[model samples]
Target chain A: MKTVIIKYNAGNVSSVSFALERIGINALISENAEEIKSADKIIFPGVGEAGSAMNYLRQNKLDEVIHSLTQPILGICLGMQLMCNYSEEGKTNCLGIFDQNVKLFPLSELKVPQVGWNTITDLKTNLFSGIIENEYQYLVHSYYVELSAYTIAQTNYGISFSSALNKNNFYGVQFHPERSGAAGQKILENFIKL
Target chain B: MLSKRIISCLDIKDGRTVKGVNFENIIDAGDPVELAIAYAQQGIDELVFLDITASNEKRKILVDLVSRISRQVNIPFTVGGGISSVEDVSVLLNSGADKVSINSAAVKDPGLLKKMAGQFGSQCIVVAIDTKFENNDWWVYINGGQINTGIKAVDWAKKITELGAGEILLTSMNNDGTKKGFAVNITKQISEAVNIPVIASGGAGTMQHFKEIFISGKADAALAASIFHYKEIEVLELKKYLKNNNLEIRI
Candidate 1:
């Protein structure tokens, strides 16, 4: 099967590419509409601010192309946030694929950016096919999509929020599966099988 | 809940892994690529490679080393030492480093942080601050902890975050290689001061030190060198201990 990683001005693409390679898949990194649309599965991976990333997607018309992709598409980290309707970071207007708004973690006595690895629970989708319910997944996010009907998994950090979301062919994960251990790799493998 | 991260730092000089105290007393550890792969398998949350060599010849060797390590491991890696410009950051990231850390160059030119953040995005730019306790205050140091900037650590952290740095890797020079414990007070001060993630480095002698850094320092991640290099504390074992202590950790 063919996989393409939507490339824009963001970080973490190389790690994702290397992960796919480990699974015996040679994924293409491309921003071209034709190349991304032709792939059997597409992975959107990013690590950056919301507004600027959204701007790049819109500027290149990748935003519309991504929304229309019929094949399974997985969004990672900031990629997942941008797949939502809007973001509080830089007041970003995203692709509106998931019908949710990404909001910044409220300033409290606790830390703002929830970094490192965190366990995910209440998984209710095929994404957790072979994975345990409360297994750990790596995450580094400042803004999060609030829990909605589409949320498949939830993670707690000062407050519990959506860790995984699914809406038809589009799937979004707030954690970095490429960096998370075996459980994370399983999630990606499931997504690939889908 | 977020599990605290345990990271091992490897100082690379002439394509080999080296460890020391306060950037002195250097000792050979192993090959950089081999050590990185070993740590990844041990469940290290992240890995950092600091290119300690200053010669122009070693620069090429470091790039090749980064490429090799990126192909071997799936975890995030950050590279530092002698990063001066946006091109430097781009070259490293292109070679497979998830993030490029700026230290002496960033302090010399504060605008470099903002510029790099704009060009490559904040998540790819890490600002490493080495601090030493002086006159009852934490002062930022540069030149591999050889020169003190005379700037307060807290103030500099706030400024860098405002300038759009994604994360801060704070190293306590006085505590480095001492293995007593993390400079908890300094880490707590900086973690409270910035909105970004603070990685506490130095003074990590035992697994309990990791617990202390997470609980008392409130740091998002703890980075150590000697303990991990010497196999004193395995990353998986450390995470298990933290989980038992009521601290969230990925197992």
Candidate 2:
């Protein structure tokens, strides 16, 4: 199946393409509206600043393109953060897909970027089909989205936060499924089947 | 809960895994991709590939190696050695590396860190600091530990984080390949001084060495080469041991 990954001025876009390739699916990465709207699935992924990323999406009008897509869409990491109503990082507004807000991890003795494999529990969607609860997934983020009604998965680091968000046809995961091993692959594969 | 990471470091020379003492007297270990897959099956938390090769052509092969490993393994992959510019970082990341570690080139142009952080995001920029104890202070070394930059290791660690380094791969030259133990003093120095995660590399002889570094050094992660290269210590057993010691481990 053909998938279109919404491209922006962010890093790690290559990894998403490579991950799709490994799963035997060819993905087109583009910022063009027509390419994104016609795809079977649209994956919006970003690994850069929220303020500038929102600016890029707004300037290219990708923000509107993403909101109008009727097909399934997946937002990863900063892309997921951008789907929220707003973000404390860079004090920028987001696409408002999940009806939530993003905030920096509360100040504590813990490291800023939760950079490692951690267990995810309380799964609430088919995004984790065939995946056992408390299975570890790789994550690296300095900010987190508050637990919202759309939050399908939750993880704890100093405090519980939304690790995965699902609302209607749109799905967002704060962790990098491309970087996580078999468990992560399972989640992506499940998404493909969805 | 956050778990302390155990990183398997593969030193690459001509695309084959190699381990050297004090960056000399090197010996080949095995194929890079093969060993990488083996480590992943053994429950390795992360894998680091250091391109110790000097030639530009060899750097290309290193990139190729990174691409192959990224396709084969799903763990966090980091490569160091020869990333001098944002383009180099892009090539490696595009090739599937989650992070690119900067060493000599970063010291040569301190601005590279800031630029890379701005372009690729700080989480992907890993600053690898090679240090040696001298005159009651740790000094930064470059060029395979041959040239001393006189930049104190602790100060450089703090500076890189401020400049937008997401993590630090702190290697102690004095204890490297010695298997004595990690330079816990210097590790603790940098780990405490910086808010970002510090990966303790260098001497790792036994499971206790891993425990000591994580406990006393306050290191977020510990990396070892020959110990894992030769299968002298199994990664699963070590993780179990660390977990038994009341430390958080993925296993």
Candidate 3:
């Protein structure tokens, strides 16, 4: 199966590519529309500000291309947030693939920019197939998507939020599976099998 | 729930892992690639490689080492020591380092922090502040805690974050290798002063110390060298202890 990682003005592309390489799959990193569209599976991975990233996607017309991808697409971290309708990080209008809206972590006793590893519970999708219900995954994000009907996995930080989302061919995760060790590797392997 | 992090810091010298106290009494730990794989199997939250050598020749070794480790390990790794410019940050990031930490170089050129953040994004940039307690103030140190920058740790932390630093790795030189616990007051000050994530480094000998840092210091992560390197406290056991203490952890 062919996999293409949508590349733009974002970080962590190489790491995701490296993750795929570890699983014996060589993924093409491209920003070209035809290249991404032709792939059997598409992966949208990003680590950067929301507004500028969306601007880059729109500038290159990848925004529309991403929304129209019929094959399974996995978005990681900011990639997952950008797949939503809107983002509070930079007041960004995203691809609107999922019905959820990304908002900043509520300013409360809990810390902003939740870092380190956290266990994901209430997993309820095929993306989490074979993975335990409460497996630990690495995460680092200042903004998060509130729990909605599409939420596949839930995690609580200050308040509970969607740790993973599933909507048709589109799938997203707030945690970095590429960096979450064995459990993370299993998630990626499962995504690849899909 | 948010899980506490267990980070193992490897001080790299001539492309090898070295362990010591207060940045002295260097002893050979092992090969960087081998140790990194072991840590990955243990399910470490993160790995930090601090290049102790400060020469042009050693940096090339560090670069090659980073590339090898990035290929071998599937977790996030942060590289520090002698990172001076955007070019250096790019080289390390391109070599598979998830984040590039700026310590002495950032103090010398604060603009580099902004430049790196602009090029690689804020999440890839980490500002490591080495602080020493003096006159009841946490003062930033330079050159591996050899020179005092005279900059208060809290003030400098705010400055770096404003410059778009994604996180802060604050190390208390006085408490390092002492195994007493984290410098809670120093960690709390910096953690409260910045909106970004603060990682408390130094003075963790036991799993309880990790709990203390999270509860009392309010640090997002606790980074230690000896406790993890010498097997004094296993990362898995540490996570278990933190979870039992009402601290969220991945177990």
Note the DockQ of each predicted structure. 0.53, 0.66, 0.57
Full-model lDDT for every candidate: 0.86, 0.87, 0.86
For DockQ, the strongest prediction is: 2
List the candidate numbers ranked by DockQ, top first. 2, 3, 1
Residue pair clashes in candidate 3: A156-B1
lDDT of 2 by residue, B86-143 (tens): 8899889877789889999889998988999888888888899999998989999998
Which pairs of residues collide in candidate 2? none
lDDT of 3 by residue, B132-192 (tens): 9999898999988999999999999999988989899999998998999889999998889
Residues B1-251 of candidate 1 have per-residue lDDT tens digits of 66677888988888877764222122333677767766777788889999999897678898888888887777778999999988888888878888889999989999989999887777677899999998999999999888989999999999999887889999999899899999999999999888789999999999899999999998889998888777677778888889899986666
Choose the strongest candidate by TM-score: 2
TM-score of every candidate's chain A: 0.98, 0.98, 0.98
TM-score of each: 0.92, 0.94, 0.92
> Between 1 and 2, whose lDDT is larger?
2
* Counted clashes in each candidate structure: 1, 0, 1
